[model samples]
Target: MELSVVTGCLAGAISQDPEDVIQGGDVLNKQASASMEGFLQANAPPETEVLGGPCEESSWIRPPVDFLKCNWDASIDGRSKKMGMGLVFRDSSGGFRAAAISNIPYITDPEIAESIAARWVVSMCAKLGFQSVVFERDALVVVNSLLSPSPCWRICGGIVEDTRRMLHQFNSWTVKHARRSANQVAYFLAKHALSLVQDIVWRGECPSFL
Candidate 1:
């Protein structure tokens, strides 16, 4: 499929306000929503911790042979109500395959921002024709929502559902949560995107800053 078609699908999926959009296929009861909300509140890592300074103890891990790992992160600016998303794709040997950074309007909620980032990365991977991929991100809530069999009912529910649908296009895929330290490349890329007026993409080359 064309990249424009993928992007158009994403735009339609998330165009409505969260309260106004509930996917028919992934609908959950209010009780389920309440229970899940509490769990998210209790277990989700703090924003600062997820976006904190680098750590020497944790590092990026390579995927299995024949697979690609995509590490993704998001940076949000409260004043601008915009979010920057970064995605770095690496091969099983840990060689950089591609990277991209994008800036877009965002909801104030961090979970929503991360959800949008996940959707964007998935769409990008689909556009790149990646069949076997592992997605890693620093937002535990967003990761959990993707991994859950039940539909997410948070404000980012629609975005999460969209991401999940896109993931089905892959032959093999998994979504995992990683430490900020393990996601440094994408983290910094997201920060770098905050200064840009347009998206940037690198293929078969590393960014100079890295």
Candidate 2:
């Protein structure tokens, strides 16, 4: 589907409550804030943890010599109904090639949020004229959905199909699941995006914070 059509579908899917739609943005904001706390609590990391430099003894694996590894993740801000997406690209030698952080409308469902992130990954990579890329995400549902041949009937099915189409445009690509710890860079970037006013893309370097 075209970008405009896909965007329209996404918007329609996100605005499911007629009451919220009629009540105005205030009601939507209240609803988002009420649910967001639970969502974040459910997804929070363990209290005891080792903090180290990026990729230090991390499970994040490198791709083949000629392939680029792209780690992608998404975070949500319920009050604003915004989703932050992050992607970090690295070569086989673990050298950062590029990174991106974007803020977009939040999809309440975690699976949908992940599916959107995957779609964004492929779309951005295609636009950058990349090939032989390896995609890593912490969301196994999304990885399984993408790797499955059977038609997806989930709410995010259309977005998943769009992602598959974009992936086919690449000379080669693979999607796999990674532990959250292994995807810390992308995860942090995603959280940071929640505070960003505009999307940021860095080529040939990574954000100083990372």
Candidate 3:
């Protein structure tokens, strides 16, 4: 099913001509990993005030100067068997930079879906040549996996590996845990993605729903 779904997205790309818009694949992946490895590895943010987990800071936080913050979230519609992923990027001053929503029709596992969402936004930022980035997600599992230098061998291992590999492209990057409240925009965009037939990208400002 995964093969067929990927093949279909690939076939559809021929007409859409994604090549004229952005590039993809292992070459870019390797380049990103190599560049990222040249810098000191970053760790996840210190645990929030809540002690054992992320705090209920229901608000967005700005990244350091010269860095961009990209928040991502994922949702699954069990009835429709669709997974929606949303990403929003903002500059250090907290101004909206870009946002994207991708509807994936086959993902069922929540962890795997979150991993896919992380990879999607990371790849998007990489393609856009973003060097310093901070990725925030409500899924603590994903954040923890990214912080670990050792590879994981779970069902979602492949996606996790891809995500860690991509972090190498950034001169400096942070994978931190944010409460769902703080991730509202991306969460809404993710839920909205359930209705989209194809991926959507917005620049400078978010859609009216935001």
> Candidate 2: what lDDT?
0.64
The reply for model 3, stretches above 4 Å from the true place, is 1-57
Judge candidate 1 at residue 179 and give its lDDT: 76
Candidate 1 global CA lDDT score: 0.64
User: Per-residue alpha-carbon lDDT of model 2 for 46-127, expressed as tens digits?
Assistant: 3322111122224978788988988888876665676777788999999988777676765545667778888888877876
Taking all chains together, the TM-score of candidate 2 against the true structure is 0.71
> lDDT winner among the candidates?
3
Give the per-residue lDDT digits (tens) of candidate 1, residues 43-109. 2312211222212226788887988989888877666566667788999988988887777765546
lDDT of 3 by residue, 49-93 (tens): 111223234578887898888888887776566677768899988
Instruction: State in Å the error of residue 157, model 2.
Output: 0.8
**Cα displacement (Å) at residue 117, model 2:** 1.2
CA RMSD of all predictions = 16.0, 13.6, 12.1
Model 1: ten consecutive residues of lowest lDDT: 1-10
Question: lDDT for each of the candidates?
Answer: 0.64, 0.64, 0.65
TM-score of each: 0.71, 0.71, 0.73
lDDT of 2 at 140: 65
TM-score of 1: 0.71
